[model samples]
Target: MELTTSNPAQPHGMTWLRDDRYSWFLAGMMWVLIVLMIVPEGFDYQRLATASAPSSGGPISRMLWLLLLALGIMMVSWRAGLAWLLARVLNPFFLLFVALAIVSVAWSIDPALSIRRLIRLGTIVLACVAFVLMSWHARRYQNVVRPILTIVLLGSIIFGLVFPALAIHQQTTPELIGAWHGLANHKNGLGALACISLIFWFHAWLTREVRFLPALTGGAVAVTCLVLSRSSTSLAATLFVMAVLLVLLRSPQGLRPYMPYLVSMLVALLLIYTLAILNLIPGLGTLMAPVTALTGKDTSLTGRTEIWTILSEHISYRPFLGSGYAAYWTAGPVPGADSYAFVWRMGSFYPGSAHNGYLEIVNDLGWIGLLCLIAYIVVHIRQSLQLLEIDRHQGALFLALFFQQAITNLSETHWFSVQSVDFVIMALATTALARSLLEHRLRLVFGQPQPSTIGTSHGMALPLARESFDRTPDGGA
Candidate 1:
């Protein structure tokens, strides 16, 4: 164990630090730290008024803050995306479009523009940096993906579920509405988060990265918190995402046969919505009757269904790039007290967060960008799933994270919001890990030949590789 001194040209006893495996471990560690920091920020960031944020008066310049981090990430990741990751699966234009979309946010007219910019920048840029760094390490080591992600998720549960419950119970105010606050802002976030965690937990158990005992407990807490949040949309998001994941990972003999879970979850959601509409659920209508009778309005949904009807008209006008980024929510994404006009006019709250990430893309970046985004989702999901099915290291966990985010995106914004920290890190880091896991699985599944080892830099798939980017701060989040 004795260590020898070394000359400037040669390394000393810490030679393992230079090993590719250590690099990967450090990368994973970096992402875990980033998520831990970001998740806390999400809970508190929304409390500040726009005037309190950095560069709060700029017209559309706040976007620069967000993009700066992405640039920093790209710089750190020495491997550019043009190589294999993008080339192997993507059309390349999607990456370009994401860049354009970031640029386009500058034209947004939201009065809180500067504050909005800082908030988004802090959330997304930080996430991008963490992900890129993790991805780079993963490029070489490949197998550390699962354990690293599991660490983030377990830690998230501590804040997202456990702490929120304790905080709610401690507060004596009758007006206090306690719900799951996992990385995002509301109960819907908890629902989405619960589903996401459940997927990861299940994935862990399924792949044996984690034991089953803890998985059930974690999954149960998440789902229970979602139920307490009382958000129909979020509740559905949790069940549907979980059901989909179970289907993907389950064997024919597994519980509910997977397909049944899928169908049952969807049916359950449809029934709930339908019941809400028809006033048909057992006691729901009785409760609604009194509330509607008292208010002379269908306060349920806070009138989002109605607003969606009205907004559906505008959505058609500029099917592409409608209004601008974070636009359209002049009426919120879900029913709530957030949008005064929509809430007042309809006697309920308009939706916040647009309720759908895909539609929001079409509405914000226009059809062109939306198409590219769609392609990315499709390709990414397809590639991720391929890995999940093979039962490799953290492959299923990656798919679970992606699925939870995508499914929840229908009714909540998990990509770049106060609640976005953990999921974003989980998605990006896990996905990068999944790429290699998939390749390995593919090798195993088909008994294919192994590729050359890492560091054969010539023509290596390095596009968007996390290591290619640097963690240099750009006076940003």
Candidate 2:
């Protein structure tokens, strides 16, 4: 009934759905689902020993996926305007990337595995879309995400201290024996979550969205967990994001015009760093000696360089289309088997990922996929800069998270993984960009009319501020 009467001009319809109780309930459920995906308590580490075995998630996970899918369908069906909004907001490059993943199933070395993983990926995408549509209001983004990070950060600290046997990793090598995992399956997972929590809480504090006491407490907890996890990559990424945030907040207006140049330089630097890490550049190891010493890591990067060496050879075989979506890593035919054997022999255990996002994309979907990702990032960065002109606080938050993920992928791959936390943040960034683009277009087509302020009292402000850009008809362009 609501779907039939929904109007584009009155996009925020279904007044009953805007009830405080319903909004909070939806937010809580979505947050819980995200946490479970990132820190799956039922994950079986033993499965890592067998690369060829069919991996199965817990019943709880299966049910959560179904619920998320159902909710996504319901939201899109009930809010026809949301469908229209997404039509204009969704990035074409990202859609092409997803399409390629689906198409890869036909050529996949392990068709069954590809299909299963693709299905899981579809579920995650659906949930992300649902979240974006549901939170299509200014400031709702912070309100929805803040409590989630706070609860997760506090809960992880408490669980790690109270249940060390369950929350801390015990089977790690003697050097990493005391590392804390804290509800996640691995210490690295905990570290990633902590890094994310630190960024969110810090942004909240900087924006004064929450009281000082809670924000400071949450940030402290996040930092402690990050340190205890003993993940050098996470620590480095957290610091990198913080530094970027500091720069952005210091002079957002002055920095806006140079954002494109800044992003390009950052990407170029990352490429050089990657090459250095891979030993492709002679004498690079000597240059990185100081960094290694600071992080207490050897030149091996804990065997990631070796994994990259093996996977690089395999990427050349199917350099165009790849071994299909996540199909090459399994113990299958030819190159897949060879690569798996090499990694197992080198590490005496499963390596799990390519340890590099760019390499992973090439391995899963080939060079075209890699290009699609680059295009997606370029577009996202441009849009985030535009957002900074209007909403400095929210815009800075998006950019900081985007940079953090970019850096994190250098040492850990989560590009297209199902229910991956990094991928989810990327999705959220895409959603924010889409929302901003839609608003700009609307202002252009509809003229600079005052937005209906029906939901402002409920903490939902229509995203129609004209503080950033010129009001000329072609200004949005």
Candidate 3:
């Protein structure tokens, strides 16, 4: 009679193991970093330093890098619904990356090389999907975004201050004609970084529980770094997002409570305008500093506009699929006798990137692919804007990210290569969350009992928290 068995109570941490939130958070981190490593964050210059082969960096390192990523994702994921939702949201765009690989099957001048590049692109996307499925939560999502802002701000500062100093230190040593190397490859990439980071910090300023001072300082530095990057697109985007911040401050019905934000924005705008009219804005210096440190006169943006013009002309050629993945104007030899005569030419210099992302896509993926990409992003941005309109904090962050992406894709220096990874992952996660939220709102409006969904407060947990979990552990339990 006394042989009754008792079941042990699960600790909170053990229960948390069953919680999709915890599993998803880990998955999200894997999604962010694994894709970044594979996509080659500095391909803008890394390809130049070494041969493009995965072997040039060594086969062992590349193999180990990918194997480790696979193992990590396998170890963490616990849910299948997350995977399917992730796929449903993102599978449409995989067609573009697959199109890159398919191009090699049909038309690679060097089939082997093209196949290799195609495989690389597919692997990156697949890895991104794996990470996104596991880590699809609003809080974990913030972890990935906030660090990105830091990296961009740090990279911008490093380039703005250090690159010029390095050039001056070795100007006469003659290692090269210029030294514009930031932590990343070029200013455009850094500018992309700045643009995204600016939006992120600006969101942090609005949504987080923290005091405003830290976010304000972060926003200023992000804007300064973006301006110093001297990318007109980045500058324009910063201003646009700043406008968004002002709107957020004023949109709340209780305007009197936010008088401080209104006053601060007005002051900031006035000061920035006054300084610019006086020709004192720092971006003006970025144009001259590189050459003045070495020679006398400012160098032209080194024919950037002319090169852009050349790429635009090429867009007419492939009006469909321009060239192929990683294919562009950079591959051809300048064979004319006049070509050899140009004194302005830098040594062995060639750029594969089209500088204009829209043109670049049209060249590589063809008209169909280009149209799909544009439509995909536009739809997501439109949705995010709607979400923000409803004052949903997570939706606002998505809106900020997509807005930055829409701007920086033009005249981008290095973003397309590195950012494909982050783009797909974020896209997968955002769409999943948005869709689930949409379904919930629809059910409530129809007066239908809400359908069960993971992480949904309906059925599983009350929308009103059972009690304050922050109270004493025993009390809450």
CA-lDDT, candidates in order: 0.44, 0.68, 0.46
Best by TM-score: 2
**Greater-lDDT candidate between 1 and 3:** 3
List model 3 lDDT by residue over 1-477, tens digit each: 000012123222111112243454545444445334423333433453343223223565457546645644563243343343334334354445465546535643345544555555555545555444442344455566556556546654664475554311222323223433244344454456666666777776676734589777777776666655556556666666567665654466665345335434533443343233223355654444532343222322334455554555655665665455553332333444222212235354445455555555665566765676656555565455455444356655665565455544544532234324334435434544454343333223222332223453211121211221222232111
User: Candidate 2 at 206: error in angstroms?
Assistant: 1.7
Q: Model 2 TM-score?
A: 0.83
Q: Which stretches of candidate 2 lie over 4 Å from their true place?
A: 1-22, 41-54, 172-175, 252-260, 278-300, 330-339, 443-474
Candidate 1, residues 249-323: lDDT per residue as tens digits?
564655433433454354344334334543334566554464345324453344445544544455577665554
Candidate 2 residue-wise lDDT, 1-477, digit = tens: 011113445333312223222466567666866776666535543442223333656688778777877886776665445455565557777777889999999888788878878877776676666666553556666677656766766777788778777677767576468888776666787788889889988888777878899888888888998988988988988987887777767656765677657766876766666667766688777767765775567656676777887887888789898989987666333344645666455755556678878779988888888888888777667677777777778778888887777767777887767636767667766765676556555545443334333443232222422221233344353
Model 1 ranges with Cα > 4 A deviation: 1-77, 80-97, 103-184, 220-224, 231-234, 252-303, 313-317, 327-351, 388-399, 415-419, 422-434, 437-477
TM-score, predicted candidate 1 vs. hidden true structure: 0.58
lDDT of 2: 0.68
In model 2, residue pairs whose N, Cα or C atoms come closer than 3 Å (at least 3 residues apart or on different chains), thus clashing, are none
Q: Residue 179's C-alpha lDDT in candidate 3?
A: 30
Candidate with the larger TM-score of 1 and 2: 2
